[model samples]
Structure formats: structure tokens, C-alpha cells
Target: MKQVTEKFRFGIDIGGTGIKAGVVSTENQILGQAYVPTGAERSWQEVVPDIVHAAEEALKDAGEFMENCISVGIGCPGTIDAQTGTVVYSNNLNWQNVPLAQELHRTFTQPVFISNDANCAALGEVCAGAAKGFQNVFMLTLGTGVGSGIIINGRIFEGGGPGGAEFGHTLLVEDGELCTCGRRGCLESYASATALIRQAKRTAKQAPNSLLCTLCKGDLSRMDGRIPFQAARQGDEAGQRVIREYIKHLAAGIANAVNIFRPQAVLLSGGISKEGTYLTDPLTALVAEEVFGKKNSFLPQIRAAELGNTAGMIGAANLSQ
Candidate 1:
């Protein structure tokens, strides 16, 4: 086996819109990166070749050859069978039962590893970003939808199967809003940026005279996560209401996760996390109040993810290490 600190690694992050690849050093440094648009409508056979092209570009940019890489790691969205390096399903890419690692291995002839994209993000943070010293960490990403990653003893924990730590899909309300996963009242339905935008639009509609309506110039479609937070900062009643409720649901989910895993820290990522202390302060208070063992047990520290968009690729690259 090669020492992790003595070799270069290739990391690939597959997303709905694009595929990002990076040549990373053993020191967790990204030497070079490249990206290609994902023609998701095309077959995986076509997509796989594009992925290879992107990797070659990254290696070239890093002034290295494929032979210099010790292994390749892939972070993809879906139920990933890490042991088999297969992607069982990915609604965004319309991929199902794809032998992703095997496909990559055929092209690169290197050891290949695969994992959930969110899990990769958590691992990235743990290895090189915010959770560096923590043995246990939980990460939440509030994007178009909510995504979660859990790390225990510095390793990704996928529960008993391929898809675990799916905090976003956890039920928050009984038969409430419909979720993208065909479930009702999942945490994503209430705590995600999508949910924030929805709440902002509905709030503006209900209170036509509120500042939230004016912020979007009365076009609900123009409303976004920032608008509500901005409006709330300006003392808008409707905006404050929207943010408050959003926090409530988000806190509930965080508390639930804390109660179960009790990690050393909980890191927040994605667009909403940019709110910084405005979001964290309130969230910390709420979680302290709601977490099951808050009064008697040590509480996990909550903070924002430091790596931003690079976490997935960086984490993927380190997987082989």
C-alpha cells in the first residue's frame, strides 16, 4: 500500500449541472482543477468518457501524468455502494445501478473509491477544513434541497447500508408539505433554501404591504433566501416571520441529529449558511433548548463549513488516501 502523504490523487465530483475534477497532492492541496458541463440527458456511457477527459485536463493542469496518481476517488449524488463502487440511484443525473468505480478504473487503471457527494463534503471538512481536529462531526448543506453527512471517528458513517445520515429526508411534520423524495414533511421541505424561498414568497403574498414584497419588486419568483434575511435585518415584519419559522424547523432537524449522534460539532454549508452568525446564533440557542440531552450532556458546537464549494472535490480526492 502507498503512503497517503507520498502520492498524488485524483478526485472527481459529479453534480447535476457539471463534473469537477482535481489533481490533489498528498498534503490535501489541490494542484489543479477542471470542469465539464454534465449533459445529464445523455447516457452514462457518454458521460463516463467526458469524466475521463476532465480528469486528463486536471492532471495536465497540475503538470502531472496519470501514472503519478495513486488512486481516483469519486463523489457522486445517489445511493452509493462504496464497497462495490456502484451508484444505485441518482435522480439528478438519472443514473441507476451504474458501476461508476469500475468504469473509472477501466480508463485510469488505478484504485477507485466512491461515496455520496455529501459524505465527501463532510470528509473534506474533517480532513482539511473546519472539523480538522474533531473525531465526530455532522454536516448539513442547505441548497436547492437539504443534504447531510456524518463522520464518526474520522470516517464516513453510512449506517447499516449505502444511504444513511439522510437528515434532510427525516420527517418533521406528519403529512405536511410534499418532498422531492415522495415523502411528506421531510426536513428539506421546511429547512432548505428551497423551503426558505417558498416561505418568503408565501409570506409576501399574504402580507402584500410587507417589505418582502417590495424587496422582490412584487415578483415572487425573484424572491430567494437572502431577500428574507435582508428584509428581516431591515425590520420587516413578514421577513422576520419567514426567517423565524425557517429557523424553527431547521433547529428541530439539528436537534434531532444532535440527540442521535452527539457529534463534537455540527457544520452548516450552502447558500443559507452565508447568513453567518445571524443564522448560527439563533440556531445554537434553539438547538440548546430542543436537543434531548441539552441540560445534562455536553452539546456539540455548531459552526459554518469553511470549504464552501471546494469541499466535495477535495474530500473526494482524499478518499483514496
Candidate 2:
């Protein structure tokens, strides 16, 4: 028999402001990485070249060549027709019905695969991150908007179609705050970092003399997600209220998911998860109270994601497996 050599893979994570690519070994470790600005305002044709460049840079960093790569996987923001490897729509990138996998396949001999960015994150955790040993997991990424990923039986649960598991858009409150999805009271509207900033700003405007307002130097526009947590730690009543309410809403959304999926673990990612115990402690307590039959059933462990932004890239790379 002719001797065979093991090959590496490429994973690309496409975001609104930037793109990331990594060279992944068979052991699931990232050997090298490259990043480039997405410049999402342009058309897909203009961005595709950059995506290819990112992969080239990563391959170079890994001291590997395209001939050695077995496949390429991409995690993109949008509704993806995974079977066809096409992007159905992406509000962040303003792309519609683009043949992404086919386009990438043209640049390299390796086969290409694509999936939703959130789903990729969940898959990454299952592969080597926080949910490494768990078969059932749920993940929430709290950034400009809320992103969610679900895993069941050690596989990505994309629902009936490629882009179906949209937990962020699940309605949490009726006739409440308007969401970016143009809906009222979505979990994203109440639990995202954007929503936290909005709540902090409103609270600051009401209590101008509070520490929360002082943190922004009396300019409400300067308020960000951190300001509320900062003010709360300083024993500022206004900031405390914002944190308390944010936690309550987030817990409600999480508990709702728990009731349905009952996963083994729920991981929190994105910039908000940096709060560590400050965020998870209260969330766990509140979710425990709301979950059905909590006294009789074991509640899922709530944890911060270990891989951070790399989860999407790692997960995307493994999609071909």
C-alpha cells in the first residue's frame, strides 16, 4: 500500500467588522491564524478575495500549503442553506443568495462547507472548549446582539433547516422593547450588550448625580455595558437596578431554553461573559428558580465559554469532519 500523509484543515469565521481564519491540525488545535477587516459595506465579490487571502496567510503561518489542506469550513453570519453551501441572507454583510462554498472551492481544490456562525460556536465548544465532554449543550453569545447555538447528542441542532435555531429571536416579553429584528421583546432586546448599554443610558439620564452618570462624565452617550457593572460595584443604586433587571430578563430567557432542551450545560460567551462570576452567579440562581421541577431534576451548569472568539473558527474548521 502507498504511504499516506495526514492533512490539515482551514476554518474561517466571518464577522461584520472582520474575518478570521485558522489552520487546524487533526488534533483540533489551531496551528496558525490570520485576520482581516471585513469591510462588509462592499459586495460579496469584493470580500471573497479577502477571505481567500486570510486563509493563505494562515496557511503560511502554519508553514503549510494548500495541497496539504483536506478541506475548508466557514462560519458565517446569516441564514445558510448548508446543504447547498449558500448564504440565503445576512443582514450584517448585506449578502443574499451567494454561492459561498462554490466560490471558495474555485480557489482551492479542497471541499468547502459552511454553517451559521452561532452554530459553529456551539460545535467548537463541543470539540475542545468548555463543553468538551458534554453531549448536550446550549450557548449564548451576548454582543451587539444575542447569538445562540444548540447541540444535542454531540451534534449541532440546526432544526428543520440550516438556519432554524434562532433562540435570540425568541419572544421573551410581549409589547416590550423593540428589537433590531423589528420585533417586540425578543431575548436579544433584553439580554444583549446593546440592550445593557441602552438600559444603563436610560438609568443614567434619570439619575444624573449617580456614579453611573459620573462614569460617563455626565455624558449619557458615553455609557457602555461596563458602566452599569462598574456603577453597581460602587454601590450605586441606579446602576444596581440596571444590572438587576438585566439579570432578571436574561435568566428568564435562559430558563425558558432550559425548560425545553434541558441540556447538560449552558455556556455564555461574547464580551459580556467577561464579567465571569458576576454574571453567571446571579444568572444561575435566577435560572434555577424558573426551571421546571428544579428540585426533582438536575439543572444544567451555566459556564463561561473557554474559547472566546476562537470557538467559531475552531468549530467552522471541524465542520468538514
Candidate 3:
């Protein structure tokens, strides 16, 4: 009888601006990593090769080869059809119905799997990050926009088909701020980093003497999600107002999700999450106060994501398993 050799897995996280690839051990440790510019404006024919090359470079960094890899997993931003391994639509990449899995399979002999990047991030956290011990979780990445991922029974939940856990798109206000999705009053319109910056700029324009304006050197473009938090910490009323309003909408969205799924934990990721206690402490209290039946039911724990940007790749690597 022949003995089997242990093999590693390759994970690829594809984004509009960059593509990240890594060789992952079964224990979820990243053995090697590589990054490449996405050149998203080009056709898939041009971009797919870059993804393949990134994988090769990552394997080289790990001192391994295709034979050493058990499989390949790709986490991409889009409406991914996991069954067909196709990207139904990705507004960021302008991709529609691309056969991503098939293309990767042609490049490597190993099996290829594909899923939504946000879902992959959630899985990564559940497997190795903040939600490691939790069987059910909801992950929110508050970046340029709000991205959400859901995990149920330790598996990514895509609802009946694909593209379900869009927690950011839930309506928060009627006829409110316009969202990137061309809708109005979405949770993302108020809770995302973009929204925070917009609020800061608007407030700064009204109060030029504000600390937020001073921190930005009188340039609104220089304002970011951090300025408001920093200003609030320094006792700036405008900054405090922005932070309070941001947390209100964020809590509303979180409470809505908690009421529906009641996951074991709700994890947050992105630059804003780096605020540590400044963000989590208040956000936790707000959610506790707002979640339905919180007086009688167990409230989900809220914490920052441990894996950060690596979660997508780690989760993608485990998709084949």
C-alpha cells in the first residue's frame, strides 16, 4: 500500500485594485504570500493570467510546486455562483458571468473553488480569527462601503442561491442619502467609511473652526473615518456628533441582523475597526440597547476581526475542504 503525502492549499483573494495569493497550511497558517496589481480595466483574458502568475510566485515563495498543492480557492467580490464558479456581477470589477473556477482549473491541475470575498472573510474569521470558537457569526467590513458575510453551522450561508447576506443594503431611512447601489437610505449610506467621511466634510463646511476641519488642514478631502473618532476623543463637538450619528445607524443595522440571525458573534473588520475600544465599546453598548428582545435573550458578542485583510485568503484556501 502507498502512503499519502500531506499537501497544502492555494488561496487567492481578488480585488479591484489588487490580487493576493497565498500558500496555506491545513492549520490555517500562511506559508507564503504574493501580491499583484489587478489591472481590472483589462479583459479577463489579460487579468486571469496575472492571477495564475501570482499563484506560481506564491508557491515559489513557499518552496513548493503545483504538485504540493491539494487545491485552489478564489474569493472574489461579486455575485458569485458557487455551483458554476462564475461571477454573476461585480460592480467594482465590472465583471459579468466570468467562468473564474474553470479558468483557474485550466491553469492548475488541482480542484478550484470560488465564492464571494465577503463570505470568504467571514469564513476565515470563523476558522482562525475573532470568531474561531463560534459556530454562527456575522461579519461586517466597514470600508469604502459596507460588506457583510454570514456563517451558519460553520458554513458560509448564501441563502437560496447566491448573494444573500447583504446587510449593508438594508433600508435604514426612507428617501435618505443615495447609495452606490443607486438606492436611497441604505445602511451603507450612513454606516460606511465613505458615509463617515461625507458627514465629516459636510459638518466641517458648516463649522470651519471645528477640530475635524483643523485636523484636515482646512481640506475636506483630507478628512477620513479616523478624523471624526480622533476629534471626538479630543472633545470636538462636531466630531462627537459625527461619531454618535455613525454609531446610531451602525447599531441599527447590527441590531436588525442580530434580530434575524441571532449569531453567536458579530465581527467587524476594516480600517475603522482599528479604533479598538473607541469603536467597539460604544458600538457594543448601542447594539445591546437596540437589539430586539435583548432584555430577555442572549446578545451576540461584538468584536474586531483578528485576521484583518488575510481573512479572505485564509477562507478561500479552505473552500476546497
Better of 2 and 3 by TM-score: 3
Which residue ranges in model 1 land beyond 4 Å of their true spot? 1-6
Alpha carbon lDDT of each predicted model: 0.89, 0.90, 0.89
Candidate 3 residue lDDT tens string, 170-203: 9999999999888999999998999999999999
Name the runs in model 3 displaced over 4 angstroms. 1-6
lDDT of 2 by residue, 1-321 (tens): 113434788989999999999998888888889999999999999999999999999987787767889789999998888889999999999999999999988898888989899989998998999999899999999999998999988877877886588899999999999998899999999999999999999888889899999999967888888889989988999999999999999999999999999999999998888888999999999999899997467799999999988999999987853
TM-score of every prediction relative to native: 0.96, 0.95, 0.96
TM-score of 1: 0.96
How well does model 2 score by local distance difference test? 0.90
Q: Report the C-alpha displacement of residue 54, candidate 2, in angstroms.
A: 1.3
Cα lDDT of candidate 3 equals 0.89
Q: After best superposition, candidate 2 residue 220: deviation in angstroms?
A: 0.8
The candidate with the higher lDDT, 2 or 3, is 2
Model 1 score (lDDT): 0.89
Scored against the true structure, residue 166 in model 2 reaches a CA lDDT of 88
Candidate 2: worst-modelled 10 consecutive residues by lDDT:
1-10
lDDT of 2 at 108: 83
